[model samples]
Target chain A: MSIPDTTLASAKALVAPVLDDTSRAQIRAERMSAFVRYTLLITVGFLMLYPLLWLVGASFKTNSEIFGSIGFIPQEPTLDGYRKGWETSTPYTFGRFFWNTFLIILPKTIFTAISCALVAYGFARFEFPYKKLLFASLIATLLLPNVVTRIPQYILFRDLGWLDTYLPLWVPSAFAGDAFFVFMLVQFLRAIPRDMEEAARVDGANSLQTLIYIVVPMLMPALISVALFQFMWTMNDFLGPLIYLSSVQSFPVSLALKLSIDTTEAFDWNRILAMSVLALLPALIVFFMAQRYFIEGISTGGVKG
Target chain B: MARLQIRNLEKTYTNTFKAVHGINLDVADGEFMVLVGPSGCAKSTTLRMIAGLESISGGEVVIGDRVVNRLQPGERGIAMVFQNYALYPHMKVRKNLSFGLRLQRAPKAEIERKTAEVARILEIEPLLDRLPKELSGGQAQRVALGRALIKQPEVFLFDEPLSNLDAKLRASMRVRITDLHKRLKDQGMSSTVIYVTHDQTEAMTMGDRICVMKDGHIMQVADPKTLYDRPANAFVAGFIGSPEMNLIAGRLDGNSFHLGAQSLVLPDELMARLRANSGSVTLGIRPQHLRVNTADGLRAVVAGAEFMGHEVVLHLDVEGERVVAVLPAADYADLDRGTTVTLTPDPGQAHVFDQSGGNISLSTSQ
Candidate 1:
């Protein structure tokens, strides 16, 4: 019995090395697969980002060198594009157009945040007469196409003698006219518990005071998301300003950028690209600064509600 | 501190479902009254109506001398602590405590003093600068309590404030809250409190007087001792105790109570206390009062025996009905299942109920 047990122990020792060898091979294969996966992902990610990179790089290139080669690298780098772009073909520089854009965006973003929050709070919390009908109509507006309302809205603004002013651009937003934003905020508000609001009421705060003190602070993340979206969308809007502001001085960056392309006989590709890169900066910077809240707001609003 | 009078309060939803059916309760100043019931019994709804948070459908809520059915919750001079400890998530503990004072436009120095005082009372001074998210569950609860206490409202409403805590923490917080109430009363402050909870242990331990509710109606309002000793109905009998009072369906005739084929002679004291003499009845016996292995009693088979350290709970099957008896551990070493035994219920502690569920064995002298 002792001799047989020694033989069994030797046999077990022989099998242990083989098992270890197989596991080592498996580890090697897993490492190789992970390397291949990361390589493929990096290649695809860079491919998607190449256009933006090329735009930024080409912005620094001389006008002659911009279309001369497919390579993004500038053989001759110069600030001539920005220099000429800053002094637009029109009398007002790009600074004036940027300032004009800011004027339109400030009130529009601020008003959208405040008005949508109020409307969303009412819809989410209170029960009023015809509440269901009113809410259904509000959601119906969400499904309605923007083009369907553009003509009637333009006619209304024209009759009001508001066609040549920024009032036509931002006044509607102050009244919670953006149904999409109102819907977003309403869905977000629905996900939040109402105990805090009730506590505020029990603490002797009236309805308006509750809205201002408790509701607004808790709604900050979603409100920031709303403001960010409104800011970026208004900054990039071309048709609204083009239809309303015919004056050269009143034109925003969007229409002003178009004016550069339209007035000149030969298109200055480098200058347009440079101005486009500059126009994209504000939205990009603001988004990065508020990236955490923007993601949190959207995810919580969508998933929970 | 002011008395709260809820008169014929009703709550009917838009779907025409009546959740609260005109219940009346009067909480005296400085009394810690608890409204307790199982889920869907509208205890929270009743408390909300008193706080002026829910609209009164058919009754008046009087705080102090004023009818506050038309007043806002804030204007009703009341404060509430929610089950979730509804501290303003953004505000620090100090700001949360002073929010009511700030809303009232009180003097800054007064707000500071009141905030500090409340923080100290709740032992949350060290947590004053921390946001609600930073505090632990127990700490957050204390901060929520301070928020209510700082208001010093005429009445305080608590909606299962400690139900979220673990068992051990819940026990500790229960004592803390009752102590706080006593301290406030001793200081001559207006400390009328209406607390709502579904946990019977919380209702039994903390309430000055408990109001048991069922199906949107009050079952009994009595002190914990009286509620245990003399329940008004079968529902109250089964609800208030931990192991629950075993209610056996039987008949009482002459001086004997019949359990199916078996019967036991009723004591003169129990017979004298009986309001109904001869009819179908429920014989209510608490587990502690049921004696096992008695010579002259109802014969039963031991279905199960649970060793609970100091005591053993014997689950017995008497004929076809289930009965439980609590016995001292020393009395029974290890009683095996299927063993035959006899359960003798103490006559003085037994209760008899008529068909309509009213306790018929309650003596008017008690």
Candidate 2:
């Protein structure tokens, strides 16, 4: 018994060192794999972000330095681009163009949210005579290319004497012309349980009241996504404003960016880059501010169903 | 005066699948009636119809003096507590409680008073500022109850309100709801409740009277005592009790109950209570009523024995039929598996049913 006990103790002592050595090896291997993974991720991420970084860096450079070096950093940064870019060749400043963009975005976003939510709610919850057919047509419009309707829409806007105004851009979205947003909201609404809506109805709320008090609050995330998409899209929309507004006073940032190129024989690279950065600012800021809800809306709508 | 009456309530889906056959029921004012059934039994559908959430294909749902079949849910004068609590996710508990009153454009002071009163009664005052998601399951359920309570509607509907809780919480909530109903009644408030659940324990404990349903039809409607002591059919007998009432198929000739290869002389009391003289029958006996190790009883082989602290549940095989007998643990502690024992069912507690699933022993037993 004593010999067996001694042998067992010796055997345990021998196995302990081997186990420790293997675990240490395993830890080192895990650390190596993790290091490789993070290094690869950081490299790819930086590569994808290089163009935006270069844009910001080149905006501060002089026109000569912007063309002279492939590197982003400038030897001497100056505020010349912003100062000169603000006062465009056109009579109005960049401020006027930004304001014009805001005017289009504000009504477009607000109306899109309201109109899309109402339409989505009806499609999701109600039973109408032609509901299936109507919804199918709505989806069909989503699948149709925007170019297909451009000529017809331009003709209609021209006949209405709305070519020189922002009505063509704002009126359609105000009437839920963005079928994609409506479809997104409808899908989101379908994922939500209707217990609270039923509870509201039981609590003496009419259909509209239930929509306002119960459905809208629950749909805030999806609604925020719709508003953000509309705001960004309208701010960046060049073709819609170009086709509708031919006047320099009503040019938005998207069309205004092209004004400098069209007016000057030799392009001032720094000024254009500066205004491009400023034009990108509103969309970037808004996207960051509402990023949490945007991701949640898309993910929950897709995954839960 | 808020008596709810359903006259031949029917529900047929658009696919032409008839979910509910025309069934009539009458629930008195202030009665705590429970609709209990297995899954797919349309108990929840019936409750939804009463609340006007589901379209009644054919029926007159008369609440008080009004025919509410055509009324919207909000206009039906009924408030419902849903299974998932259904508290407004965006509102605080106070707002949730006062939503119905605010919708009615009641006085601001009245809304405040009612909100506070309901909060105090449900013991959710501390959670008044919390959102529905922040509250625990029990707290959310209380808030849901307060939402319905504050409405002061003519009738209240609950669609398996406690089913989402764990077993322990469900048991406690069952008592809480029953106590709340009693408290409201004592205060002379109109608390006509139509609660639905599939758990028989909840139906047995919480309901003033239970309406047992099966496949969209009412199987039996009786107090818990009558439902247990004398189930109207084999389905009710099998569904009501734990370990279930043993329903063994056998035949009866004269005064002898022939069970497969064995036979037992029927008790005089049972023989007198029999509706049919001599034909095929299903013998229904509760586990507790089966006496073990009697000298003059039918022999059974003990297939299994579970020692449950104070009691022992013996799974026995009697003439190729499995029967469960619950006996006192102390007396049967030494009983081993595959042992032979005699089981004598108490004559007074045993029930006999005919071929059509109707209790034949109930008439003379009562």
Error of 1 at B293 (Å): 2.5
The sequence of per-residue lDDT tens digits that candidate 2 reaches over residues B21-104 is 999999999999999999999999999998888999997899998999999999988999999999999999889999889999
Q: Where does model 1 sit among the CAPRI classes?
A: medium
Candidate 2 Cα misplacement greater than 4 A, ranges: A1-43, A302-305
Q: Distance from true position, residue A244, model 1, in Å?
A: 1.1
Best by lDDT: 2
Give candidate 1 misplaced runs (Cα > 4 Å). A1-28, A302-305
Candidate 1 DockQ vs. native: 0.67
lDDT of 1 at A296: 82
> Native-contact fraction for each model?
0.95, 0.86
Each model's Cα RMSD: 3.0, 3.4
In DockQ terms, which candidate is top? Answer: 1
lDDT of 2 by residue, A1-305 (tens): 25688888999999999999999999999999999999999999999999999999999999999989989887799989999999999899999999999989998899999999999999999998999999999999999999999999999999999988989999999889999999999998998889999999999999999999999988998998889888888888889998889999999999999999999999998999999999999999999999999988777773220
Clashes within 3 Å, all models in order: 1, 0
